[model samples]
Target chain A: MAADISIGKAPHPLAVLPFYGTGAGFFAALAVLLFMTAGELTGHHFNPHVLAIVHTAALGWGTMVIFGAAYQLLPVICERDLYSVALAVVSYVLLTIGTILLVWSFWVFEVGALMITGGSLVVVAALLYTVNTCATAALHQNSSVQRAFIVSSALWLLITVIIGLLLAINLRVTFIPRNHLDMLKLHAHAGLVGWFLQLITGVSTKLVPMFLLGKSKREWLLYAALVLQNVGLVLFLADGYFNPITAKMLIYAGIVALGTAAWLVYLADAYRNRLRRKVELLMKHTAVSFACLAVGFVLLPMAYYFTDTRWVSLYGTFLFLGWITAIILGKTFKTLPFIVWSSHYRHLTGKVKVPLPKQLYSERLTVYQFYLYLAAFVLLVAGMIADYMPLIRVALVLWMMLAAVYAANVAKIIFHKPMITDGNRTQ
Target chain B: MEIELNSPFAAELVKAQTALMQVIDPELYVNIVDLGLVYGVDFTNEAKVKVTMTLSTPGCPMGDAITGGVKNALETVFPGREIEVNIVWEPRWNYHMITDEGKAQMGLE
Candidate 1:
């Protein structure tokens, strides 16, 4: 038993956390894209609509997925089972319901709804997630890569929730000053780069290698990357909230330096340990996304220095649409197939022959969507930089179409299979 | 495959579930038996025992502890029976696998 169930063989509970969390996040993000695109076309500066899209993506999609990953990972690295599966189920339900309420409040633009119920549910979900994860991790005597991911993720989630509630209340009552949009830049950064990006990096450091059937050796590099990213996020957030000039410059500088280091280390690690020597199309597209991230990061600081807000928006376009969304798109295709395969077909492994996880979806359709998104991303950035609202609107519509294609592709993998496999199996 | 009746230690196999539960799993704070993990037991009159069990999931993290706990408990209980344990993933454990008592304990009722 011990021989067959070694370090890599035994299942990690935290692994599933990332799967469910990322899955929800991807869908939420696509939904936001859909709504935001419509708003752009209709010429409505609907702030509530924007808030809904952002939260749906950040809180609903990003935070939830990170929680799932952390739950699965903590046990493996810490050498422990979760304190309770019941807690996990509870956490998932709260988060799912909370996201729905919050998004609904935003779509309706009801201050009372957003403030009263939306705020409470989001808070409850974040607290539940944090408590469950922290308790589970506390049971382990020693820390692991998974532990690091879970801990940092929990902390950022707390901050993200608080900021979200504050913003929601301010929207409903205007108790806070009207410079709320400016204040939101800080909150948004804290949630996106600090909470979501940090968690993804920590988990992906381990997951990426596991996917490639290789072990991670450079633990120190990962630690350094994590530290740099967090420190940069802290500095960036402080400056955005209090000191605009320094915050703008320092945030850009800090992110570029940190993001570059992390990216380089990521590339080196992938190159060193990567098995299945032939890089798949998903990885190829992912590489392109990283390249876009590097370009955006470097260009962002330059734009800030030149006092070109247009360039700043352009940089955002590159990062949000080009890098982040693109990476999610590519990785989702890889992850969704495996998850659907496991949930639907893992039981039938020895009993009957089945198609591989990669075969669950159409690769050709995904590839086509990837290209369309890339093209749309490029045009949108160009339009934003040139202040061409019409062009931006058109590009956003194209992006919506691409998102639909990606969502459809993912859905086909999950819902295409029946729950019971071969009811005729005799024990 | 078949338990032989000749050795004084053969009866120890029937008590394997009781024996395993005596050992505690520190992480979950529940015995393997109470967790409804032990699936079957086979004993041979030659003083050998075989224990089969299942885990909560394919990639259970505390599998080592549970298996080790079972071995330790059995060794302490029978002292003379040579024990062999097998962990199987077939007919995978789910909520339905839990006994009514286990279900009550788990708050699944």
Candidate 2:
């Protein structure tokens, strides 16, 4: 009968920072022609403009946003307060400055000393975040959901940074591998799929159902999916550097099995609880993202059948640009608006009349973006498969345009416009 | 409309229940109806309503948010209505307060 003291009374302002970062990251890519086209014109693969766009998107836009959400959600699910908000703020500052230094180093590749310093700062920031999550879990290990996500995410982050530092050292003083791109597949996958995608899905398993009025009953299936993924990733990284055919096959099989099983369970849950019969744009796009995941997973086994790396690249295209980014965009719509609404309007009740949360969005625009994304993803994947350069370029442009629209929608939510008349009547 | 003096109050109760369902705790992510919070709702007049509810646990952080949400939701349905939310800590909320539907949703037999 004792009350649970852990429930947060208000939506923290710090939590919404990540949403803003996501929106910013989505739009910033267009500014530098995403670092490649600009590079071609300027005859410099390493330019301040390109570095700014890349680092801004990667660290400023992606990692920071993820950090903000985790700081708020991890504590709640764990039924404990975070290790230190002050420490979190410190980590954020270090990461921000570190990213700036990194972009500068990219432009001046001769700055071996500077690269080492920036890389160390990034590692420290990751360490701080890792320590924060692990320390919080040490208290009241009640929520298994929180524990799994925090631990797994932290481990992957450590792996990501360690690999990153080694790469930097190689660039500076040839400390490890001779080939700069040798361990790249491992480094990229560890950070992308292992650290980012794994954490996102793990958290989604809990949040998606809680927000959307669904239930996740297949805990065992989730665990199975998780283990298979990690095993595959580790094995892939170990032997993939040498380009072993058997190792590649095992990795592809493992990824396919993991993605398919998770998708099935998620779709089944969503279908069962959609009795309200009101399918939001976010849900529609989320299903689209899962379809991309399924297709990408299915294509993995094809890599063994084919001898070309083209199939592998196509599979990567579907997984990264198609599945991972799509999910992030789709989920951000639901989560950002809610966070903004709660923080801004929760206290306005009883003082006077207030507009409903549903009034804050244009459902029409969101639905359009969802359909456009589906078309763009399909075109892009097909182009990649067919080796049609023109089609691939057009699809990327379309993807960028849709992403721009999504970014603008998120920006409006963050800025907090009066969506209805007489909005100020409620204090 | 058929005029029935004896049970004219039945329609008002249904209207009140519908309004209550719209109220929700933003943080807990559950509405008052499913939280087993609403104990009773009494209507003194067409423009006056009283709600009696308990929290999941004593000193729940969501106590104020849920109460505010209930008031807001009701006011929206029946504007300028006099609403009073009474927070009680008696027979403290447990599995018993959960209706069969709520139990099913929670997967509790």
TM-score of each: 0.68, 0.74
Mind giving the per-residue lDDT tens digits that candidate 2 earns over A5-24?
Answer: 44334335563455365435
Give per-model CA RMSD.
Answer: 11.3, 7.0
Q: Give the interface-residue alpha carbon RMSD of model 1.
A: 16.0
Q: Where does the lowest 10-residue lDDT sum fall in candidate 1 chain A?
A: A5-14
The count of backbone overlaps in candidate 2 is 0
The deviation in Å at residue A104 for candidate 2 is 6.0
Per-model interface RMSD values are 16.0, 6.8
Q: Candidate 1 — which residues are off by over 4 angstroms?
A: A1-46, A64-85, A104-109, A172-179, A214-216, A238-256, A302-309, A389-394, A418-427, B1-109
Error of 2 at A116 (Å): 3.6
**Can you write out model 2's per-residue Cα lDDT over B17-64, one digit (the tens) per residue?**
666666654433445676577877777666778777776643333355
- Candidate 2 stretches with Cα past 4 Å from truth are A30-32, A35-62, A80-83, A100-111, A177-180, A235-256, A259-270, A273-275, A301-309, A417-427, B1-64, B67-109
Tens digit of per-residue lDDT, candidate 1, span A182-254: 6676676676666656666665665565444344466776667667777777777666666544435554557
